[model samples]
Target: MFRATETFATHAVANQPEPADPPDPWADDPALRGRLAAQGGDAQTPAALGAAIRDGDAWALGEAARRHPPELRLWDRAGRRLDEVAFHPAWHALMAMGLEAGYAARPWDGRPGGHVAHAAMVYLLTQAEPGVCCPMTMTYAAVPALRADPALAALWVPRLTAAAYDPALAPVAEKRAATMGMAMTEKQGGSDVRANTTRAERDGEDWRLTGHKWFCSAPMSDGFLTLAQAPGGLTCFVVPRWLPDGTRNAIRLQRLKDKCGNRANASAEIEYERAWAQRLGEEGQGVRTILGMVHHTRLDTAMAPAGLMRAALREALWWCEGRRAFGRRLIDQPLMRRVLADLCLDWEGALALGLRVAAAFDRGEQAFARIGVALAKFLANKRCMTVMAEAMEALGGMGYVEDTPMPMLYREAPLNGIWEGSGNVIVLDVLRTLSRVPEAREALEAEWDAGAGDPPYDAALAAFRDRWPGPPDEGDARLWAAQAAALLTASVLARTAPAPVAEGYARARLADCPPVPGALTGLAEGAILARLGGAGPAGESE
Candidate 1:
C-alpha cells in the first residue's frame, strides 16, 4: 500500500530531471573521455563510428548507440490485441554494439569481457529487446564448444549478430536478432524429456532431425538447438538455417504464436523435414546440456518478471502520488497505501528469490541446481503475476488502459511462468529432485527418533502415508498432489529447523519458537518412501 508521503511526489524526488547540457565536444571528463580513450573512442566522430556497423565490432556498437539511441516498443495485433509495446531502443543499439564489438564470439574466445559486452546484453534484456539479446545469449552460452569448432561458430555468429542492421535480413528475417539461434520446444515433451517424439536418423556422415517444435522463438535464426531421440540416447543438435549450399532447409513455419507477451521477438511453430543437424555433446548428454541451458533461462525468466514488476510499480506509484481523486491524492487513502506496501513486499520476495537462485547458479552449485532453478522460476514468476495484478487494481481503469504501461506489464508477466516450464512442470521437477535425495529420506526417519527435528515435515510425511497405505498408482492425481504438497511442507521445515538451544538467555529464546507442525513432517516421510520405492505420482514414474 502507498501512503501519500511515500507516493511518487515524494519518491519522485529520487527521480530528478536534470537540465540538458550542450553536447560536450571533448573537454575532459575522465568518466566520459577516460572510458572513451580506453576504448579507442577518443579521436573518433560519432559519424565515423556509425559507419563501422559493417564490421559489427564492439566499438561500432558504441558508435551506433550514439547515433540511433534507444526506446521501448509495445504492440497490438491483427485479431488478438497485446497490452502494450514496451522496450528501450538503447538496448537494441547496444546489441548492435555487441555484434559490432565482436562480443558474439565463442564462450572460450579470447576477447576481453568487462562492462561493454555484458552491458550490451543486459541492456537488451532489461529493456525488453530480447530479439537481439536472446539469440546472442544462446549462441554465447554454446560458444565455448562453438569456438572449439570455429568453422561452425564463425560462419554463424556474424550472420546472427548482424541481423540487427542488415536490410534484407530484417525484412524477412529478424534484422534485430539475426539468424543464429532457434528455439527448441515440443507439444508432448516439454519437461518430460523422455516423452519426446522427434527422431534423428543417421545418413552417412550426416544426421537428419525430423519433428515439430512449438514456439521457436527466433525462427529466423540461422539454426535451432533441437532435441531428438537417438538410437543410443536422447541427443541435442544444431540444425542450420539453410542447407549446405545455402538453400532454405526443409523447415515449415506453421504459424507465429500469438503470445501473451514478448511479441517483438518471433515465436512460431515449426516443422522440420529431414533437417540436417550437427551433434552437440554426446548422444546421452542431450538432457544434461539442455537442462544446463534451462537453468540459465529460468533465471532470465525470473528476472524479466521482477524487472517488469519494478517498472510497473514505479509507474503506478508515481501516478498514485501525482494524480488526484476526490480532491485528494490517491496515496492519501489508507487502502491505497496498503496496496502499495503489498506491492513492495511482493517485489521484495520475488527479487530475493530470483537473486538467490541466480547467485547459486553463479557459484556453480550442482547439487541442488534443479530444485533451486524450479523454486526461483516458480516463485518469481508467480510473484510477478501477483504484483502486476495488484498494480492494475491499484490503478483502477487507468491500469487497464493502454496509455499507461501497467496493463501491458500485467498481461505480459504471466507468459514467463508458462513458457520456461509451466508452473506444474517446475513444481514436479522440484518434487522429483527432493524425492531422489537419500539424505532427505534418512532425515525424515531420523526426525521421528530425534523427536525434535522439523516435526511439521515429519508429521506431513506421516499423514501422506496414512492417506495412502500402499504404493501409489502412477496415474493417481492424489499422488502428485501429495508429492508437491509434501515438497513444499518439507522445504519450509528444512528452512525453519530450530536452532540448538544456547546455554543461557539465548537458549531460552530458541526454546520459545514453535515446534514444527506434524502434518508437514508426515508428508515429507511419505513422499520420500514413495520416491525411494523407485516411483513417483503417475505420469512421472520410470
Candidate 2:
C-alpha cells in the first residue's frame, strides 16, 4: 500500500476531469470523446486487437513482437521460416481498414484517402515491425502529392496502390525490429533531404536516376522511393528494383549497417547508376511531398513508444499481482501498490493524450494534428522510458534478467523517442506552434476554459496582461506569444477541476473520479475532502 500510496500521490496531485453526466464518464473531456468518436464508431480496436492478436486473422501485431523480441534469438533461430511467410498480414488488414475507416472521406476524398491509406500502412508497420531500416517504403506513397499528381496520379496512384498488397512485390525480411523499406540510407545523407546528391535527369521518354542510397531495408523492393537533385531542385522518384530482363536494377549493394535493433529486416546501402525511374510530382516538390508523408509518419513513430510502454506496464502489473514478497503478494505491499497505481495513472494520461492527437487527424485538423502528434510522441516516449526503468526497479534483479520482458521493452521505448523526430525536435515543434499559430492556441484556450468553468474573457485577459509586464515595441507577435504562453500555462492549471467527494462516488475500486496522475496531481497539494454521507461502494470505500 505504501507504493500505491506514493503512486496515487502523483495522480492525486496532477488533477482530474470535472464531474460529468451519469451516462458518459468521458463527457467532461471533449478531447477524449472527440478522439473516441474519430477512430471510427468504436474506440475498442485496441481491446479487440488484444483479444484476437494471436489468431492469424488478427494481423501482424502479435507476430510483430514475435518477429523481433528482446534479442534476435527467434530470428536467428528461424529466419528462413519467417521470411517465407507472406506479406505482413498487418499491412493487408491495415490497408483494408484505412480504405474502410481511416480513409480521408472528405472533400478531396480520393487523394486524401490515398494519403491516409499510405499513412496507415506506414504507421502500422513502423509501430509493429523491428529493424534499422526505414519505417515506410518511402514507397511511392511517401511521395503522395507526386503520386496523386494530375499527370502522375493517373499513372501511379492506381498502379502503386494495387501493388501495395502484391505478395510478389512485398517481401518480409525475417524479424529485425527496425524500419523496413526498399532504399537504404546514403553514406552522406541519411535523413538530410536536401543533401541527397542523387540525380534524376530526363532521358528520351524516361527519367534516369543515378545515386547511392546507403540504408535500403528491402533493396529488393519492386521499386524504391529515391531522392535525387535536378537542375531546378531536389526531386523524389520511384525506381524499379529490377528491369524487364528480370535482373536486379543497376543497384549495387554497399553494406548493411550493423544496427542494434530490427536486425531481421535487411538494410543494405546501395548505389544505383542509370536506374530507370519515374518522376512523381513536379520538380522541387519532392521536399513537400516527402515532408507531407513525414507529417503522417510521425504519427506512426509516436505509436511505437506508446505501444512498447503499454506492453511493459502490462508486464509490470502482472508481475506485481502475482509475485510474492515477505509472505504477501507484491501488489498487497503498500509500496508496491503505490508504484503500480502511479504507473497506471501515468499510462492513462499518456494514452488519452496520444489518442487526443489521433483524434485531431480524424477531425480533419491537420495543424492541430501535427502539434498534438509531436507532443504526444515526445511525452509518451519520454514517460515510457521512465516507466520502464521504474517498472524494472520495482521488480529488483528479476526485471533486469533477459528472461523477463522488461529489458526489451526498456530498450525499445527510447528508440521511438529518437525515431521520426528526436525529443528536442518535438519540443521545438511545440514551441513553434505556440509561437506561430494563434488560432490553434486560441482553440486550445477554449478547451481549457470549458474544462475549468470559464472565467470572464475580458477579466481573464486583463489579468493575464497584468501578470506579464514588458516593453511595448516588441509588437503583436510578442504580445500574442505571451498570451499563448499564458494560455498554455492556464491549461495545465485547469487539468484538475471539481474535486471528488465521498457523496459523488459511483463505483467500486473506481470512482467517477480522475484516475490519471495528471488529472489530480495539482489538487493533491492542498485540496480538502468532505466525507458527505452517500450510498454505494464508491462512497463506502472512502
Candidate 3:
C-alpha cells in the first residue's frame, strides 16, 4: 500500500553540483600561448604551471584564503615589540606557488619577451588566488625603483628573486627569500604623492625618516619603498625593517585596515620615529624614480579585473551548464546564451587589451604604452565590476551566498578600479598625455588605424580620433576613455582573434557587422565555449 507521492521510501540528502579538480587551463588556451609566442617567451612553463594550479592545490589554497584571512600580531609574548603580521600557512603556500611559477620576477629575466610572459602568467595565477598577488606584485614592481640606486639594487635583487618562501621575520641574510612593500599614501594625499608630509633628514650619512604612512601594504616584508620630504625636496627612501647591525628599526605598526576585500594580505598604518632609511634617487626626484614602479603596478592592476571576470564567468557557466530548469539546461535558453556571449566578448576583449599593454612594455614603446595603459586601466576595471554582477545574476540564488566563489569575486571587483588610481585619475592621466606629450596622439592614431578593415571601423576610428587633438577637459574624460578603449580593443581583436570572434565583437560591440546571432546564437556549444566555458559547478566538497 503506497501513495502516489511516496512509495514506501524515505527522503535522502540532496547532493548539489560542485566544481572538481580542473584540467590544465593553460594548455587548452591557445590564445595565451599565442600571445606568449609573439613575445618570444616559451609557453611550456606557463602551460605546465597552469595545469598544476588547476589539477593540483588550487582548491586547498583557496580554502586557506577563505578560512584564515591574515592576522596581525603587534607584540611578542615577552612584552617586546614585534610589529608583525601572521598569515595562514596557505598564504605562504600560495606565495610560494606564485614565486615558483616565475610570475614574480620574470619581467627581469633578460629574455626577449619577459614582461609579456610575466603579464600572461600573472593574469592566469590571479584567477586562482588574488590576495597573495599583492605582496608579490609590490616586490616585482620594486625592482625598477631599486635600480635607481644600483648599489642598493645589487644588495636586494638576489634575495628578492629567490623562489623559496621564508616567512620568519629576521635579517635578510637569514632568509631564503625576500619581499618588499610600499608606503606612499597618507591620510592627506591619496593619489597625490607629492603632498606627502613624511620627512627625511641626513643622519650621519645615513637617512632617518620620521612621519606616519596611512597605508603600508605587506608590512612583514624585509624592506619598504617610501616617500618623504627632505632638505632638497620630495625624496624616495628605502627603509629596511632591520639595520645593518641586525637591530630593529624605529617603525611601529599602528593598526591593520579593515578592507572591503583583499583580506589575505595585511594593510597597516605605520609610524616612523627617525626610522632608518637610505636614499633611493637624487634629492627632489622622488616621483621620477617611483613613477616606473607605479607604471608597472598600474599594468598589473589593469589585468586583475579581467582575471576576476574570467573566474566569475567560469563559475557561472559551470552552474548553467549542469543545472536544469524549464525542462532543459539553463544554458540552453536563448537569453542565457546572449548573456554568456556578451560576457565572453568582454572577458576576451579585456584579456586581449591587457596583454596588448603588456606587449607595449616588452617593446619599450613608452609613448604608445602611456596612452594604452590609461585607456585599458580605466575601461577594463570599470567593466570588470559590471561583468561580475552579471555573472552572479547568471548563477541566481547560489551566486548570492557565501557557498560559491561569486560573492568573493563580487566583493573584490571594485578594487582594481580604485587601486593605483581611480577612474577619474586614470582618465585625467590619458588626457594629460594626449594634451601635453608630443607624438602621443600620433602613436594612438597609429594603433587606431591598425583596426580599420572596412568603412564601419574607419568611421568609428574617425569618430574616436576626432574627439582628440583638441583642448582637454575633465567633463568628457569618461567618453574619451570609453572610445579610446573600444578602438584599441577592436584593433587588437581584428589583428589576433579568429574571424568569428572578430565578427562577434564587431556585431555586438561596434554596431558595424550584420546581426547574425542566428548561427553564433548557440548556447555555447563550440570552441569558443570550450575556451571560455567553465568546469563543474562551484561548491565546497564534503
Candidate 4:
C-alpha cells in the first residue's frame, strides 16, 4: 500500500446521471398535438417550435439556469433617472424564444383552436421556465381589457401581437413589439382593488395618476394596465413608460420585491406623480373593465401548476427507474411505485380538465370557463405543493439540492394558489360567481353529462351535489370547489381515457379516504414518462 499509494473509497457510490431535457418538449407532451388538432389548430408550426423549446442547443435553458436574478438600476451612469431593470442575457434569450414561438399571440390569431393552441404552447414552454411566463400571460390577458376602449385596442393590440421581444426601456413607437404589466395591489388591501387610494385627475381627454402600488409586477414592460380612484370612482388606465412626445413618464420605481420564487422576472413596488395616462373605459367601472382580463389570467395561472406537476413527476419516475436500492431498482419498490402512480393519476386528470376549459375559451363558453378556471386554480394549485413534496421525498436527499430542478420546482409550487387569488379568496370567488353568474353551476352539470358512462363517477357527482346543495356559500365554498374540481376531472378521464386508467383515477382520487394500496396497473410508467418527453398515452406524436 505504501509502495502503490492507493486511495480508499475514491469513488464511493458514483452519482447517477440526472434526467436530460426532452429533445422536443412539444413532441414529448402526451397530449399536446391531438389536443391542438382537436380544437382545430394547424399544429405544424407549434410542433416544430417544440424542439427549440426543448433547448437542445443549451442556450435557452442555460440562460434560465444562471445564478443571478434580474437586477434593478434606479439611475444611469450619467446620474439620470433611468429607472431601468437589468437582466441576465439568459432571461432575454428565453423571453425572445417564447415571443417568437407565438405563446402570447395565439389567442388573437383568430384561427381554429387559437386559444387551445396558445394554451398548449404555454403549457409546454413554462415547464422549463416559469418566471418568463408572467409577462407573456399579462400581454395575453391585457387584450380583452384593452379592447374595452376601441381606440386603445386599435393602438396597442397590433404591437402586442408582434413576434419580436424588445427589452430596451425606450419609446413603444420605436419597438417592433411590446409587452404589458399589471398593478392592482396596494398596502391597504391585497385582492381588494376597491380599497385602492391612487388618485387620478383629468387633464383634457388624458389623465394624470399619483399614488403608490405595493406590488407592480413586470416593471420593465412597455405599458401597464393600472387602477386608480378618479372623480367617478375606481378607474382603469393605460400608463406607458414614455409620453407620446417620447419623454420618460413620472412613474417612479421604489424597489424590486425580494420574492422566494419567480426570481427570473422582476416584481417591484413603485410610486408615481402625475404619470400621464389614457383612460381604458367608463369611469367608476374599473372592476367591470378588468373582469374580462382576470378570467384569462386565471386560466393561465391554473395551467402553470399542472405543467409543473407533469415535469416534476417525470423526473421522479426517471430517477426511480435508473437508481438501484435495497437490491432492486427504486421504481420496483412497491411504496415508491404507489406514490408515483398517484402523481400520474392527478397529473393526467388535471391536464385533461385544464385543456378542456382552454378549449371552452376557444368555443366562447364564457359562462362555463369563468367558474371552471377558479375551481381548477384552487384545487390544482394546492395539489402542486403536495405533489412537489412527495416527488422530492421519492428522490431522497439529492432532490433537495439546487443542482437538480427539484428545489426550484418546490419553491414555486405554492405560488399559483397565492397569485391572482389566494386559496380562500378563490373559494369566496366561487361563491360570489355562483350567486351572480348562472353558468357557474352549468359547468359542473356539463361534466356530469360527459361522464355518465362510469357508475362511480356518476355516484360521486350525486354525492357532491348533495353536500354542496344548491349554490355554495362562504361557509362551504372550499368543500364545494374541491368536490367540483374532482368531479369534473373524474368525468373528463372517464369519457376519454381507457376504462381501467379512468376508473383507477376515480377509485383512488375520489374516495373519502384514499386506500392504503393504490396502483394504476394498466397505466404503464413508460407511457406516463413519455408524456413528459412528447407522446400521449396512445403513443401519438407531433
Model 4 agreement with the true structure over 408-431: per-residue lDDT tens digits? 889889888888898888888888
**Candidate 3 residue lDDT tens string, 1-542:** 23233233677433244445564557656766665665456575577568768766675686677679877787888989888888888888788777877776677777666677777777777777777888888888888889998888888887777655667667776677789888899999988989999999899977999999999988988999999999999999999998877889999999999998887778999999999999999999998888877888888888888878888998888888888787878899999988988877877778788888888888888998888888888778877887899999998888999878888889889988888888888888887888788787788778888888855567777765565667456666676677678778878888878766765776666653222122122243444444566442345121
Candidate 4 regions with alpha-carbon error over 4 angstroms: 1-9, 12-15, 18-22, 34-42, 56-66, 513-542
What TM-score would each prediction reach against the true structure?
0.60, 0.63, 0.89, 0.90
lDDT tens per residue, model 2, 68-166: 422211123644311121334444454333222322222123432233223223332333333311423333324344443576445434444332233
Q: Is candidate 2 or candidate 3 better by lDDT?
A: 3
Candidate 1, residues 359-466, lDDT tens digits: the string is: 344344454434555655665566577678888887777688865556556667777678668866766665566567644334333432333345544454556557
**Cα-based lDDT for every prediction:** 0.51, 0.48, 0.79, 0.79
Which pairs of residues have clashing backbones in candidate 3?
19-537
Off by over 4 Å in 1: 1-124, 127-137, 140-182, 437-542
Collision count of model 4: 6
Return the candidate ranking by lDDT, descending.
Answer: 4, 3, 1, 2
As for lDDT, the candidate ahead, 1 or 4, is 4
Candidate 1 vs. true structure, TM-score: 0.60
Ten-residue stretch with the least lDDT total in model 1: 501-510
Highest TM-score among the candidates is held by which one?
Answer: 4
lDDT of 4: 0.79
